[model samples]
Target chain A: MDEFELIKKITPSSLSHREVEIGIGDDAAVYESKAGYEEIVCVDTMVDGVHFLSSHSSPGDIGYKALAVNISDIAAMGGYPKFYLVSLAIPSGWNESAIETMYEEMNKLAKLYKMDLIGGDTVSTNGPLVITVTVIGEIEKGKVCLRSHAQPGDVVFVTGELGSSSAGLALLLEKISTKDEGLAQYLIERHKRPKPQIEAGLICSHYERVALNDISDGLANELNEIAVASRVSIDIYQNMIPKHAELHKLHTEWEKFVLFGGEDFELVGTISSQDWERFAQECADHQVSVTQIGQVSQESDIKVFLLSGQNRVPLEKKGYQHFK
Target chain B: MDEFELIKKITPSSLSHREVEIGIGDDAAVYESKAGYEEIVCVDTMVDGVHFLSSHSSPGDIGYKALAVNISDIAAMGGYPKFYLVSLAIPSGWNESAIETMYEEMNKLAKLYKMDLIGGDTVSTNGPLVITVTVIGEIEKGKVCLRSHAQPGDVVFVTGELGSSSAGLALLLEKISTKDEGLAQYLIERHKRPKPQIEAGLICSHYERVALNDISDGLANELNEIAVASRVSIDIYQNMIPKHAELHKLHTEWEKFVLFGGEDFELVGTISSQDWERFAQECADHQVSVTQIGQVSQESDIKVFLLSGQNRVPLEKKGYQHFK
Candidate 1:
């Protein structure tokens, strides 16, 4: 099929949001802004071999993950994802059905958030397939969560378990083995389809002075960013970092994955001690796991620290860094 | 350099616009929405070896054109360019300095429009380099031009000359030889840096019920889109279509380039006959060439027609379809 036909086949017949004045099949998408909301914009690109292995990932999984990662950014900002545009550079070997399946998977996730697929571009590429998704979201004028908002007395918390995605990736790449089929499948799911913590982010936005960062580049790198941006020191208890219960069964060094492996898509942030009780309760009511992992301190000499029993060691900012 | 350091190096110290509350270094960029404006969004991706040859075009040219194409989409909607995000997938062979030059070139263009560079992703890819730009612009509420707003009695108009970009590309590829060095250089610049018709678009927006479309996909294809969308027939006088004065001096079928060539990045649309005189006067004052190339007709049987003397031929939609 040609580009226009493929677009027509993939575009959803109806848009979910009234804010979208013009969807696909336009020179540009038009969105009428609301009176009291601020817009959040972010773009993320995933390449065939760099971001995902096409051999291991289904087309649906690839598409879902591409859009999910952008949504996670919106969640990190304590915003609601309302619209998205996807630009795909398809390799010649791929079939039309694969492209359609990708959009279908993306639409499935977008429907859950009431987000509209506004506009995008599709072109043939001679190299690996590249998918870039740009998401436009909104939050109340003064409610955006930023990394620089962390305060000295705030308690750092993380939503959901970390390192499972890395374990899942390791298993998929055959770098590690797990005897339990159920655990292996669960970890693989975690790697391929990460659920963005939008509900937990919304709960954080209700409270004042919450600084947020999505853990895409591992816990160490993300925490260091928060500390450096806020100009505060952070200390994390080794025992308090949340891990999947079945992750210990794997043969890999699970601690390394938790500390430095990336693509968790979980929100890590700091909140005032006074708001932690109410925030934790709200998250619990929504069935979202919330754990207090660290604390922000006034000391600026050490940007990040790991506290293991008695010894306190400075944490190195190590994660996925491109062009290293 | 790592991703973080590279981002820090490229990010502007001060944003050009106050609406951009949070720029790079965050999960997402935040923008304050204005009360009387509607947002216009568009995305375009350029892949190495497909869109342009690395040997022929500089990194600066590729970067500028990548963002320029997106800005053209915004211009087609008669919107004022505001902010943009760029996602780049760099191949292993590319150096940090080349990437910096790319951003610097893009920033120069952004400065011309007072547009701010917000947030985007940079990742290492094993395949060809890819650049995807998403532009966010705004227009007065209810003033956005569209392809579907053409009327039966409207006069068809196009801004600037056509066919120069295609001629330039041919010269770059050595498909056609040109002895005139000045004309060759001019055509090459036209192909590498086709300025978007933002001023012409803003002028069109000031008038009521103007149908606008960008000529990225050739005159025939773009006019056919307007005809189909507006459910009207269009006729273009072959002799009236504007061309560069020096374009005919080259040994090539220049008419084919004007009609079927893509990436000219000029504006083509329909305007009411009653408003054409004032619109033409305004465009002349701004030094934007507005030519009346054709007219819209009430007949819906034929979508688009090209008239030459007494003969009329149906214009085929034959401009740049991927995966043919």
Candidate 2:
């Protein structure tokens, strides 16, 4: 399909919002910010073979995951996603039906997040398929969370279990067959559609002296980022990490996945030691389990320890880094 | 270079603005909008071998053009460019120094436009090089321009010359050895660095009845877009198109380049008949020449007539379409 035809076929006739002055048909999308709120913006790109393989991911899943990653960025900052612009670079060989399915899935996710799909460009590419999404969000003034706000004595907490997505990816890559179909499906789905911890971030943002960020580049890397940005150190106990039971049963070194595997999209944050109890109670009310995994320190070194009967053994591994 | 190290090297240490609450090295960038102003957002992508070939275009040119195209979108809406996020997908074999040069060129453009280089993603791609830029701008309430605001009897005008970039691309691809060194460099530069018509757009936006859009596609295509969106027809004299003099001298059928060529990033706008003289005077004062090219008509069909001895011949061709 041509650019205009594809846009006309996919563009929604109605994406009603009070702040939207102009929508998809304009040169640029225009919207007003509500009073007393600041805007938070984030962008992410997903490539065909590098980010996902079509053999493993459906068009729907690919579209959903592309938008989901940006949603995770906004969720990491404790903001409400308001609008997004998507630029698709489609290769010539791609089918129009698959393109339609992709937009359908993208629209479904936008509706779920209450976000309007604004304006963007769709161009033909000579290489692999690439989708880039720019998400615009809003948060109350001074309420947006930051990675550099972790205090020296803050208690580091992580929402949800870690390493499941990485474990799921392993299962997909190894082509492992399991008798437990349910377990296999669950793990694969974890890799396919990881949920962004928006509620947990929102709850954490309300508390004083809180630092928040999502675990997109693995747990250790995110913690190190928080440590480096906040100018503090972090110490975590290996036993404190919440790993999936199925993952542990399958792999002996599941902790490696938990610590170094990325794309979990789970929120790892730091709250002041004095406010930990109150934050935990609020998190419980929100149905988000909070686990204390580490503590912020005055020294600027990130250290992970395995607690033996009497002594602590240092477990050294940095988080996953792209282009390494 | 690793992603973090590259980001660290490229990111500006100090990008302080009153509206920018948080800048780079964050989960999401945050900024506050000025009261009574709305936000305008646009995104565009450039892919290797599709948008440009590295053999012909330098890394700096590719980076500058990538950001410049998005700037043109903001300029089309008459908005003040404030910030942009860039996502780079670098293939495995690319040089690190070239990547650094790309970022440096991008930074130079951002500085020139008074925009901040905010947070974005850098991932390794197994395919070709890709760069996606998302820009955010601000305009006063109800001051943003739209393509659908054209009215019947409005005068259609375009800023600067048309088809130079397309003509430039033709020369670059053919490797035509021209002894006129100045002419060759001028056309090549036109393709490499398109200046967004920000000042002209801002001046035109002050008028009460204005409809504006950038001519990224050819004049014929953009006029057709305005016609379709505003539900009005447009008619122009074939001789009125502002083709580059050198191009006209080089190709006997140079009108085709001016009519159907893309990538000319000039502004094509409509102003009511009564406001035409005033707009023209203001444009002249700003050192921008405005040429009256066409008029919006009551009928909903676009037509360009070449006056041949008082006999008008119709020009057939719907302009360039990506898939076609």
Candidate 3:
């Protein structure tokens, strides 16, 4: 099919948002921004092999994960993503069905996030497939979260578990044994389809004296960021970090996964100690699992301590580095 | 440098916009949307070898053109190009100087257009360098232009000239005669550094009976798009199209460059004959060159008439298609 024909066939009619005045089929998409709110914009790119492998992931998962990662950015900022633009570059010989499936999956996630797929460009590539998604979101004025707001004596908390995604990646590469099919599948799913802590982030934003960030890199790196940006030291207990039970079953060096692996898509934040009890109660009421792992200090350095027998080592501040 | 370090170094210290509440370094950038206006979003991508070659273009032109093309989209919509997000995928072995040079060039253009380089992600690619720019613009509520709004009797107009970009590409590729060095350089600059017709589009938007589009895919393809979208036929006088005189001197197939070449970044719009005099005066006041090339007709077919001695042929509609 020609570009116009393919676009018409794939574009969903009437993306269910009154604010979206124009979606596709225009030089640019138009939308109305809600009153008394600040608009948040975030963009991310996923290149084949570097971000995902077609050999291990389905077309839908790739599409879903691409949007999901950007959503995690908005979630971290305490905003609700409302519209997105996707630029896709596909290599030759790729079947049309796969491209259609990718868009279908993105549409499903867009509806789930209450966002409209506004507009973007599609072109052919001779290299790896590249997908870039730019998300526009909004939050109530003065209610947005930032990494540079953690104060000394703030209690550090993390939502959900970490390390599973890294473990999942290892399993996919066959670097770790996959004898237990159930454990292998669980880890792989964690790596492929991550759930962004959107609700938890929104809930955390309502409280005063809180700073938030999403754990795209491992928890250690995120904590360090909060420390550096806010000019406060962070000290976390290694035993307090939540990790999937399957991670230990598959990898002996699971600590590396928990501390240095990337792509968890969980929220890490700091709340004042006085508000910890209230925050914990609210998390419980919302059915979100949040664990207080550490505390912010006046010292200008981050430290991770382990209490486990024979493994009581201070963790290094290293995380995933794309370039050497 | 690592991704984080590079981001910190490349990110501007502050963008001088009161609406920009937060710039780079956050998970997402934040800005206040002006009241009584609609936000317009556009995105475009450039791939190495497909869009331009490092051998033929400078690093700075590559960056400038990447953003320039997206600006053309906003210009077509008669919007103010205010903010932009750029996602870049750079292959290994690319030094920091080249990346910095690219950003410097983009910032120069951004300053010219009064746009802020808000936020985006960068990743290391094992493949070719890929740059995707997402532009956020604004237009007065209900004042945005559309291709489907052309009236049957409206006269078609185009800003600046066409075929220069394609002819420029031909010179760069060494496919055409290079004896005229100055002409070759001018055409190459047209290809490398296209100026988006932002002023002309904004002037045209003031009129009630006007429809607009940017000529990115040559004159013929843009005319066909307007015809199909507005459900009217377009009849054009081939001799009326504004082309670089040097293009005629370079090649025998000059008509193909004017009709089928893409990447002109000039505005194409239709204005009612009643408003033609006033519109032309306004364009002249703005120092923007515009030419009347065609008229919309009742018949549902686009025809281009070329009058030559014993040779009158209706032009075929063809443009640059990424995939055959």
Candidate 4:
């Protein structure tokens, strides 16, 4: 199918409310905020090679992931995403069904998060697919979160198991543990569909967490960012780091994958020590794992130590490097 | 200079603003709104081949156009943009100073408009250069402008000349027009730096114009949209279209460049006929040319007539095809 056919098929049944003065199929989309909350504006670019592979990722996966990543960004800021405008550049002859699938998954997620798909520009180019989705979310007055408030003595926590995306990628690339039908499908899903920790972020924000950030660049690099931004140090207990047990069955270097693997898209946020117990209960209610991996300190460097083992290593910028 | 050097040079002296909880070099730039207005959000994408070309546009031009385009989206809805988040995908090993130059132009425009550069994502990509800018604006309730509000008798007006961009492109591609260096420069500048009519949009909204839109696509196409949305028709005078004298001197063939050529980035909005004089003077005070080119009609088909030639032609759906 052609692009238009695909767009028509996948265009959501509900794309606008009275608040959306104008929707898609124009130079831009125009939306209004009836709630009167300040707009939480964000733009994310998903390019071929750097963010996703056209060969490996399906069209629905691309569409879904594009919106999913932007939603995750909104989640990181402790805001409820309200609307999205997508700017897409895809190769000519892009399949209509594939495009529909992409929008279907994207629509599913948007409905799940209560954010509206408002406006954006769409064009075709003679190059790799480039999808940029900008989402606007809202937070109660004076309730928006940031990443620079991780005070000394705050506890650093992450939601969900790390190293899954890295493990999934390794399983696909190396073929050491995958090619088996069920396992391959599982790994592929892990890499393509990122679970946004919106509920946990909202709960944390309500409790006035010290700081928060999403870990798209793996643990070490994210911690480095929080430490640098907040001017604090961390001593992460390696044994306390959560890892998917099934991943260890596929890869030998579990620690390396957990530390430097990319595309995890989990929340690696900080909270005050007093709020840790309540956060734990909230995560429990949400059925997502919450692991306290480290503590904030007034010291200098970020360090990693194994509680069970004596080995300790100072991390030097581990995780995804876009240019390198 | 390289990318790193470029970033260092254009970090913006003395910080962006106090509302930015975190600026560049973090997961995301955090913003806090203090103006107490509701949030309005929009995003735009410009690709090298689809939106521009490096041989035709430099980094600074691309950057300025990038911001201007997104701001225009906000203007379409009668909103004042406040903050922008930019994302770029440039070929690795490209000019470093070019990125810095782009940022310099962006900050200059941002400061001029009282908007802050809050956050953005940058990465090296194998594909052609892609720049996506997302803007957040604030709007008063019931004042958000839209294209669906046009009435049958509303006067259709446009700001600035129509075919300068197409005329400019023609000169560039033909190369012979370079003989007139000053004229060539004027056309090229118009093409590269098409200004967004933000202030005019605000004033029009305050006066409650019947309808509004920006002329990124050709005038014929934009009018068709307003017509379809309002379930009415527009009668435009062929002679009333404001085209540059230089463009008329340079081109002999109509070829629909004036009628269908796009990227003018000017305001193509409408108001009641009674308000035409007041609207024109209001636009004059802002130093923007506002000329009535058409009138809304109850008829369903748009009719473009040359009263002098005693000729009438139905406007065809000829303009930039999004999927093509």
Candidate 5:
């Protein structure tokens, strides 16, 4: 089928929100801006063989993860995702049925967030498939959680456990083997479908002077970003890092995965100690476990350190680096 | 260099607009919405081999065209271009200096329209280079010109000439030869840099009940879209269609280029006869030549026809279609 025909087949007939003035068929999509709210815009691209392997990931998983990563950026800004535009560069070998299933999977996640698929472009590529998603979100004025807002004496907290995604990726790649079939399946699912911590981000927005960053580039790299942006040093207790019980039981070197591996769509941020108590309590009510693993320091070196027992060492910002 | 360092090198340190609260360094960019205006969003992707040849086009031309096409979409909707996010999947062979030149060229066009460089992604790809640009624009409430607004007795209009870009591409690709060196250079420049008719679109926004579409696909394809969307018939005099003076002198299949060739980036739409006089005058004042080429009919069947001499024929919707 042609690009127009494919678009017609996948375009949603009705939008869930009344704010959308124009949808897929127009030259551009129009949406009404809410009063007292600012818009957050982010665009992310995932390439086959770079972000995902066609042999390893199902079309659904590829589509789902592509949108999920973009949504996580919105979540990190403590915004409500309202609309998204997806541009796909499909390879010649991809079938119409596979493309339809990809859009179907993406739409399932969009429904959960009440996001309308507004506009995009679909072009044929001579190389690998590329998917680019641009999400438009909204947040109350002055409620945005910026990474540069962290202050000394603030407690750094992370939502959910780290290293699970990386471990799952390793399992998928067969870099490590586990006899526990259930554990392997669970980790694989985690790698394929990561949950963005939007609720936790909303909680951070409620509190004052909180700095937030999403953990897409491992705990060390994310914390280093927060430190550099906020111009403050951070010290984290190595023993306090959270890990899944099944992951902890593995004999593998899980510390490297937790500290240096990437693609864990969890929120890592800092709030004042006083605010952390209430923030942690609020997150608990949502069935999300918030763990305090570090504290911001008055040092101006913009460094992150691991407090392991009686010694402190620099935490290297090591993770996935494209074009390195 | 890694992704973060590359971003730091290219990210504009100062944004031109005060509305941009967060710029390139954040997980997502935040901008305040203007009161009494709605948001218009559009995205377009261009692949290396499919959209433009790497050997034939410079890095600057590729970047500038990628952004210009997306801005044209905003112009078609009668919106003021504001911010744009660019996501580039760079091939491994591309050097850092080439990438920097690309951004520099894109920024030059962004400055012309007062658009801010917002958030985006840059990653290494094992495939061909891909560039996806999402532009966010704004229009006064209720001023959006949709393709469905055409009515009977309306006059169809187009800004600038058609087919120049396609002719230019032909010259660049050596598919056609011309004796006029100056004409060849002009066509080549036109192909590399097609201007978006934002001023003409703004003029259309001031009038009531106008239907607008950009001529990215050939004039025939674009007018067909308007007719299909508005459920009306459009009849145009073949002699009234505009063409560049140099292109008119070509002995090749220039008629086919004007009717079915793509990538003109001109604005085509319909305005009420009463509104046309004032709209044309205002566009003339802005140094834009607006030509009335056709008239909308009351026919219930959606179709487009060309009036050539004494005979009339259906205008076939033939233009660029991926995966054809």
Candidate 6:
């Protein structure tokens, strides 16, 4: 495919200079940096095989998910996603329509986030398709929550149940059949259009929440992240963990699916003991799912205890790695 | 061949940030978007054949250029680049050291710009190597110059001479022997390490320039851009066009090189006829190479005249196109 033409299609249509000083078609674009506000930035990449399969979703879903995952990174930092720049590398000989359809979906979703497509690049690759997005956000001064602030007694909470994306992957991989039409749709949507907890992040930005992260690497892998970053220990109770009942009933390897499979763009954050009630009230007001699954302690090792058994289990890094 | 290891090797050492709400390893990276400033954002990509020679340049040069080119775009808009995010696609068989070398160069330059390495993604590609960088900058209010403001009776000016980069590329490709050391080095530097005209842009931003664009696509192409954007006609006096005497002595096709062969990252701008003296003064103060080449008229066609033995010949598009 011709690279620039591919770009002209996927380019965000909002080229107005209202807030922008300079639009595209230049060496660089210019924007007014409001003097008093903080600037937030994040980036993400999606490979054809590692991040998605051609059989799993539509071009629109791929575009939306690429933008969403980048936004989720910003959300995890307690920021509102503002602007985005996308870069794509697709193999040559692909029909031009594939690139155009991807852009149509991406631009539509970009408008939904109220983020401008300021600038990016495009090129032809001989390998599988690769899409990368760098998203910039804005947050107030002293309001951004980081991943190293968790104290010894903070409670770990997660929004939404896990295993839906994993189930969706199984549907794509094994061609698993779902008896319920709605269940099949839910699994697919969960897998394809995993929403970033942007609003929750905005709310948590003000509170001195314990260590924070997004559930991109599954619960166990991400929990190990907080434990390492905060230099503290985590103890996740197996019974307290929230799993989709439908997923558990439909899948034989329920625990493995729930614990290790990734692509769940949920906000897994920690809050101080004093702010637990506030967090609860806020989640209730917003009608968001916030499940208390664990707590931070002074211990050196991260442990996961099963309610059905009397033993504790050490956490593992089952999160996805590019070469592994 | 392992993507993560390649990334780690290329990744620059990060700084301690109390302001980074969430650093890398999340769905998105959140930054402190300071208030009272409007944010500036831009992105650019470099494909192997279109932008560079894989055999001539190292991975480090590729990564550095990925960032530097985007920064140049922002500088052309009179903004201060502060953060950079890059996306790369490489063949799976590429060694990890190549990736590390690229990141090391990018990280070195990022520190030079005082810009943060916020976040980005990597993926395997079967096609040519590709690097895309998204850069964010800040501009104070009332300072951004745009390409749509030129009007009739505006004086057109360009920074530096034309055909340096063209000659440089020719020297590399045609394997020519040059007698002038400085000229040859100048051409090569123009090709390999283009210096963005940030100082000139800054000076012009405070003036009443009608329109401005960088000359990455040659003078005629840029003038055509001004003519189209401002809906005004431009007529460049053939004698006013700047050329290096060494180019004429060395090559028989000097006119073609000067006219259409691009890759000159100079600044082309328009000013009110009355401001010509002031423009010259600014150039002198900054020790910037600028020449008055043309003027805008009430009509909209762009014309180029030849000064050969009193014969006048209009020039054509001597610039690059997507397909070519």
Worst 10 residues of 3 chain A by lDDT: A301-310
Worst 10 residues of 6 chain A by lDDT: A300-309
Q: Candidate 6: list runs displaced more than 4 Å.
A: A1-18, A21-27, A33-36, A175-182, A301-308, A321-324, B1-38, B108-112, B175-186, B249-251, B300-318, B321-324
| DockQ agreement of candidate 2 with the native complex | 0.81
lDDT of candidate 1 over B29-87, digit per residue (tens): 99997888999999999998888778889999999999999999999999999999999
Q: How much does each candidate deviate at the interface, measured as C-alpha RMSD after superposition?
A: 0.6, 0.9, 0.8, 2.8, 0.6, 2.9
TM-score of chain A of each: 0.98, 0.93, 0.94, 0.89, 0.97, 0.92
Once model 6 is optimally superposed onto the true structure by TM-score, how far is the C-alpha of residue A25 displaced, in angstroms?
5.4
Q: lDDT per residue, candidate 5, A1-324, as tens digits?
A: 478788898899888889889999989999899999999999999998888888999999999999999899999998888898999999989998899889999999999999889989988898999999999999999999999999999999998988888888888888887999999998888889999888888888888788999888899999999998999999999889898887866646888878876888999999998888888889999898899998998888889999998999999888754213
Per-residue lDDT of candidate 4, residues B1-324 (tens digit): 344455556665555456555555544555665443445677777888777877878888889989988788777767788788888877775677788788888888888778877777777788788888888776776676677778878888888888887667667666336467888888778778878888877877776655777877788777877776667777788889988765666766643667887878887877888887887888888887788888887665544333325766678646753223
Where does model 3 exceed 4 Å of error? A300-316, A321-324, B300-316, B321-324
Question: Against the true structure, candidate 5 has what lDDT?
Answer: 0.89
What is candidate 1's CAPRI-style docking category based on DockQ?
high
Tens-digit per-residue lDDT, B33-66, candidate 6:
4444445677766777767877776787778767
Residues B1-324 of candidate 2: C-alpha lDDT, one tens digit per residue: 577689889888777466899888898899999999999999998888878888888999999999998999998988888898999989888888998998889889888767898888887787889999999988999998888889989998999998888777777887344667788788879988988888888887798868888888787777777776787767776778787777877577677778877788899989999999999999998898789987877765555444434666554436654223
Q: Is candidate 4 or candidate 5 better by lDDT?
A: 5
In terms of lDDT, the best-performing candidate is 1
Itemize residue pairs with steric clashes in candidate 4.
Answer: A60-A102
For model 2, state the Cα shift of residue A323 in Å: 12
- In every candidate, how many clashes are there? 0, 0, 0, 1, 0, 42
Candidate 3 displacement at residue A219 in angstroms = 0.6
TM-score for candidate 1: 0.98
Rounded to one decimal, what is candidate 5's iRMSD?
A: 0.6
lDDT tens per residue, model 1, A253-289 = 7798888878989999999999999899999999999
lDDT of candidate 2 over A1-324, digit per residue (tens): 667788888878887577898888878999999989999999999888878887788988898889888999998898888898888888888898998898898888888778888987787787889999898999899898888889778898999999888777878887444667788788888888988777887887787667888888788778777776787777777778887777777777777789888888999989999999999999999899889987886765555444535766554447554323
> Once model 6 is optimally superposed onto the true structure by TM-score, how far is the C-alpha of residue B238 displaced, in angstroms?
3.7
lDDT of 1 at B87: 96
Q: What tier of docking accuracy does candidate 6 attain?
A: acceptable
